[model samples]
Target: MMNSRNFLDLEEVRMEVFSGKISRAYCYVLVKQGKIKAIRVGRKILIPVNEAARLLAEGVN
Candidate 1:
């Protein structure tokens, strides 16, 4: 399967990623916890493009 599709660094994700509203460290923790899907490219983390929406709609899976 193809990995790393075009993901929006959207405002909400940015807020969560940048502002400590959610905390980037926490996001990575979720990935490690298998709460959300993710992959690392070298030193960078990539969250799935649909992650925020999926989280909003379904939550924590």
Candidate 2:
């Protein structure tokens, strides 16, 4: 059900992707680092599927 257009919640990414070690603030850090893209909708930040893939790929390094 996940597509390139889908946006992931920051909290979900923190738990699922980073395994609870990364905080939401650090998610913003990734954005700042240009490792991912954050879409700000109101007060929440969302990660697109492609950007999430980029972050996951970064773990290989």
Candidate 3:
């Protein structure tokens, strides 16, 4: 289980990481491709802040 404080939703990732340039579907693709790590809680997918930061630092391929 992830602490909410350390996680961001896909929407936040889309907006903050990709600056809303990427679609929500693309975020799912990253997860599926193992590019981003995520956990599914019920129907909600939670992405760790560190993962987002890593993506920012590493840039998306």
Candidate 4:
């Protein structure tokens, strides 16, 4: 199982957390909006598992 300490890529977030309802562009927006905690590792954007869960539970609305 995934945990807070683990980091997930944007695609993983879309596939697993958001269920692909949101696009990569929106995911970038979410990171920019500061709704979710994330970091850039080279060309990839990664989010913490717990933060992703929090964002889902809270919703972007």
Instruction: Find the candidate with the highest TM-score and give its number.
Output: 3
The lDDT values for all models are 0.60, 0.73, 0.86, 0.81
Candidate 2 ranges with C-alpha deviation above 4 Å: 1-5
What are the per-residue Cα lDDT tens digits for candidate 3 across 1-61? Answer: 2245889999988898889998889889988898889999999999888888888889877
Model 4 accuracy (lDDT, Cα): 0.81
- Candidate 4: give the clashing pairs: none
Put down candidate 4 lDDT per residue, 1-61, tens digits, no spaces.
2654588888888888888898889889988988777999998899888877876788765
Model 4, position 2: C-alpha lDDT score: 69
Cα misplacement distance, residue 53 of candidate 3 (Å)? 0.7
Ranking by lDDT: 3, 4, 2, 1
Better of 1 and 2 by TM-score: 2
Residue 58 displacement (Å), model 2: 1.6
Task: Put down candidate 2 lDDT per residue, 1-61, tens digits, no spaces.
Answer: 1554588887877776788797778777877776667788998888877666776767623
**Clash number by candidate, in order:** 0, 0, 0, 0
lDDT of 2: 0.73
Model 4 segments beyond 4 Å from truth?
1-5
- TM-scores for all candidates: the values are 0.58, 0.69, 0.86, 0.80
What C-alpha RMSD separates each model from the true structure? 5.8, 2.8, 3.6, 2.0
User: Which candidate number would show the highest lDDT if scored against the true structure?
Assistant: 3
